[model samples]
Target: MAFFPSLNLVARRLGMYRSGGKGAWLFLPTSSLARSRPGRLRPFHAAFSTSAGAQHSEEENIDHESSLGRAGISAFKRAVLARHSTKAFDAKREIADETLAAILALTLRCPTSFNVQPYTVTIVQSEDMKQKLAACMLGPNSARVLQAPVTAVFAADLDPVQLVPRVQSLERRKRGLPEAYLATLPFSVAFLAGKGHLAHAFKDLFTTAMSPLQPMPSVSTLEAWSYKNTAIAASWYMLSCSVHGLDTCPMEGFDGRRIMHELHIPASRYAIPLVVSTGFAMPLPSSSPERNEEAKKSPRFPPEAVVFKDQYGHAYKGISQL
Candidate 1:
């Protein structure tokens, strides 16, 4: 699930220090980065082009060999580089069941906090069901939903704390760990949930007091935590679809309540975070300016602009020297 095998390569190229001994973190170079110069860094702009349309200039094209110095691109890199938020899909094109299964299998491997896997994906393929779901969508998204062959509703469990013990116990049992390790599961869930207002107040007080001494996660409702985890899975799902030669459009402009009701998803138990429409992208017509414009990739800020090193405001040394 480690997306970037290049990280360890980068670490070694930068002569990063690692603890030496058994059971210690090892920073080993990969075959891909073996040909890359130790001190040399590729220009961020030259590394990869964000422009997706065919109309981009030669300079705007991605220099994969120069950037990665690898004979072939990794599947992870290929997926990340190729993925774009598709606005229109070819209604005639449908994803095969096997391909869809593979995409879902990869998506499910995405990591979650404490391995709770708090999200649920509802796949809608029926024409009638797609129309019903599209009715809940707002703006142009409704049209997009109707166009795609499949739409996945990503929902987060409203009461994810209740799932913690069940998931943890199952995981422990599978690993042949002692059952006694889960003795504090109930107490832990209660502490995390902070059920009543009084309990919430106490929990907030404890977090506030402890934060000054050590780092603590910002105090938030269980719903917020669930959404955070669910978003991760949704992102992975999009990339997985892209890897399978499919395109996805993630839509947040939907009536969550209506979607839940239509799908028979209990609002008390789950909340819709977002929905993604997946299918082959519609081919652009030569004379269609709107389609061509939509195909163009939006500009992105350079790594040096957004990424920081040891402290905020300090540029990351590696990217800055590129």
Candidate 2:
């Protein structure tokens, strides 16, 4: 899936040029990343807020037990740089189940809006199923779909408000929210969900009506929220694939309506966001010796163009200048 909803936004904000086309993203080989380069900007010295009890709660500290360990930082750097869209995959090369599980397990730790993880991933690997899915795609992706070892369809739960009780309870305890407000959370969620009462409830419930109580938590459109959260999780999964020496191609151009119907996905509950094709890439043809070598690097905006200071237009001086 395209991480950002708009390619034009990415181009305008970061000054990046998409490699193959609008949907295509190029991944570099891990060996190509320089060991000394910092992965990203360090805007603040503290990792989190130091205000009293401003600390991240145990539930929020998902990375505390990260298995990425000593090599985690470098591994992530290589993965981010190396992950690119692989237009072709070696159909013969299959990913081990264990490897896929590890990637999925780590990536699932990514945060969702209000911790309500409302995404569903369906993995299609059988040759018969792959062929069926390929038929659903419109462009060159048809060939790419069949060639890949596995295709994962990511969907979002349409009724994410159902998860509110579980999420709010955990978050309330972790974040030190008042226990008195817990009883009324479900009603507030319902009020916000109802279109007729939404505007009044959104304004009154969080403000004047609840003035004696604390502020009501934010509850926006579930469809939009689910899409954003699912995309983030999918991105993390793709990066994890790169870290494990796997390649992935995220495709939003597929016929999602066909997929949902053909696959017997519950249309009422889930909404398909995108499909991802993942596996090892095929070896370069002997006729094109330089293609493999050239794959290591893709066009990217320079650091100075993308990074900013306190303001949007103010470009940050890169470490090279500092």
Candidate 3:
């Protein structure tokens, strides 16, 4: 009898075998089976499997190597090093609409809890509107806003009822989730946006009690949650601007109430987290050597000072070397 690997053995090793009842066998190319010798099983390689399996294996190898490669690391490091908060922007320079749109597109990919993006970015481009927004800013920030050709206001939607369920349903549908799963979105939203302080307090008590047994995320008010998620998106927006060769000044000195009124955004529904001005940076004068040196030496706390090994206050081994 010609020797062949058992179907079970082939399935365990190759994971490309077809499934069926009693007489089913691993499908190897006829040439391979024919080449098998009596009383000696031939070893199988992934190259000998189905084309789909070979292609899948190739893709997995490529993805694994690329993820660990230095090219991606160097690019990300460059972006981080290039990013800085510009004190002044060139008034004559303007970002192309397409570039701005691309930056916003990447910014929208920032992660949010439960994938509910509870934020809106209002773009201010008109000179009249920019002037009005500048009036809403305080001191030096007001000048920066007016100097930049474009400004974006990042607002967190305090009321989840306005956006949560709709966004959840759309995202779920794209993933081809079952209707039964999608049906739970409204209830989930209601739980996230608890009915009142009394309800939230009760829920928090229950989760806090359960914390010793398993992991539980602390429940926070909707306003707090919205601000947390919106801030993440705003951070991503600044990085995206840097990657596009645009300088940004993130200002929190704006009058939120006045901005809401000027933009016709209802204060009850949304809260401004940050306002960012984006444009080409003003060129530094050659005469200001001392100022240029200060700009180059942007200070930061050492990693050892901020990062712990496994617990708070524990020294991270070899971090000082880094």
Best by TM-score: 3
- Global Cα lDDT for candidate 1: 0.70
Q: Rank the candidates by TM-score, best first.
A: 3, 1, 2
Off by over 4 Å in 2: 1-70, 166-221, 286-296, 319-322
> Which clashing pairs does model 2 show?
26-84, 27-83, 27-84, 28-82
Following a full C-alpha superposition, what root-mean-square deviation does model 1 have from the true structure?
15.9
Best by lDDT: 3
Q: Give the candidates in order of lDDT, highest first.
A: 3, 1, 2
Q: Write the per-residue lDDT of candidate 1 for residues 69-96, one digit (tens) a residue.
A: 4534676767776788887999999989
Q: How much lDDT does each candidate structure score? A: 0.70, 0.66, 0.71
Tell me the number of clashing residue pairs for each predicted model. Answer: 0, 4, 0
